[model samples]
Target: MTEAAARRAPTRAPEQDPGARGGVRRSSVRGQVLDALRAALVDGDLAPGEVYSAPALGERFGVSATPVREAMQQLALEGAVEVVPNRGFRVARRGARELGELAEVRALIEVPVMLRLARSVPAGRWEALRPLAEATVAAAAAGDRARYADADRAFHRALLGLSGNGQLVQVADDLHRRSQWPLVTGPVHARRADLVADAAEHTALLDALVVGDLGVVQSLVREHFAGS
Candidate 1:
């Protein structure tokens, strides 16, 4: 665990608005835009503390300011970005205390949730996660920023059933986007040997969860943050 990552607090939960939120059924234009942007943030294409404008984004998405503003509001509520008074929004700043608090809250939410998910954290699911996990490792090795970031998050998402709490997973998504985790595992450090260690830890968690080893799983989970 790096001293830097270990010190981040939980004040700024970053955005996880990626992929499609409302599905492709065309529920609302704003919702879809929000989903795409959130996914971008989670994927690290949109780094923490990056500033962007709603109008420009709306134009880029072939929409208007209304949906863009609405989507930004939803993201703000999720703690991904902050809406400046006159300025649009900027990715929340990262700090030790902020990340620590985020980690603490996530632990509170996920530990019990995962405890409950113990029954459902099956081998079949582990098998499914294998490919994602392997991809993450490969990304780390190859220094593929985009692939690593997306694959890393996907591996976590692949376990949505393990936590058995959709809300818990959402909470994690919200926190990680803003967390210094990007700095730790982000592409800037994609080729770092330490990141490979982090990938191994993720695999360890999967193994522990698969075997229903709560003690080890929870311990590793906490250490993941502590070591970060």
Candidate 2:
């Protein structure tokens, strides 16, 4: 072939990089947007029952509307938001009754697990979780609701993960996330004192578990869920 003709062959489109198709990159952006949206929900930045447009959220996150829409779709699937067709998404309005029901269900599933772990798992294991518990306290002390929520869930997930039951951990994590969402009315944001108090419970619960104090563990678990 002539050299000119060879140069005109366009180099076979450079083998079409996989991420260039928007698969990996788009998925990463969507995941980030989803996480940000969830944090907004937990921080009460996204008020319950209030409508939010994809473009507006995208502006806030400094991304295109496509990824924001994709993220909102996932949130909708998780019951965190509802579609509004041609408008935007509306954050799900959870009432006191629903929150109470979630707390009760969580207590039912987690209390027994905590009690079992307290009796069986080594004191060292419980002690090892001290960092996670402390992380919650640090986040709470900073008055960062979103950070506290993440730390709180991480601590609980670590605690339940000791049960060696993957399904149980997943179920409990879902309920925990739902419970962190702000309610439709009354106390949209947690006071710094309330957050600090809640975080302190983690340390106290860990202390109880470390010493195998089943009674204290049980009491703390119930009170934690009740106040949550």
Go through the candidates in order and give each one's C-alpha lDDT.
Answer: 0.64, 0.82
- Candidate 2, residues 99-188, lDDT tens digits: the string is 999999999999989888888999998999999999999988887777788899999999999999999999999888888877233452
Which pairs of residues collide in candidate 2?
Answer: none
Error of 1 at 192 (Å): 5.2
User: Cα deviation in Å at residue 135, candidate 1?
Assistant: 3.7
lDDT of 1 by residue, 1-228 (tens): 122212221122112335757443233555667656665564454567878788876655566666678788887887778898777888766677777887787667555665666566566666667777788788678654445566766776666546556776776766655453334433455346755776787888888877778888878877876755
Worst 10 residues of 1 by lDDT: 5-14
TM-score, cand. 2 vs. native? 0.87
Indicate which candidate wins on TM-score: 2
Q: Which ten residues in a row have the lowest lDDT in candidate 2?
A: 4-13
Score candidate 1 by lDDT. 0.64
Q: Please tell me which predicted candidate would have the highest lDDT against the true structure.
A: 2
Give the residue spans of candidate 1 off by over 4 A. 1-32, 39-51, 58-67, 112-125, 142-150, 177-187, 190-195, 209-219
TM-score of each: 0.63, 0.87
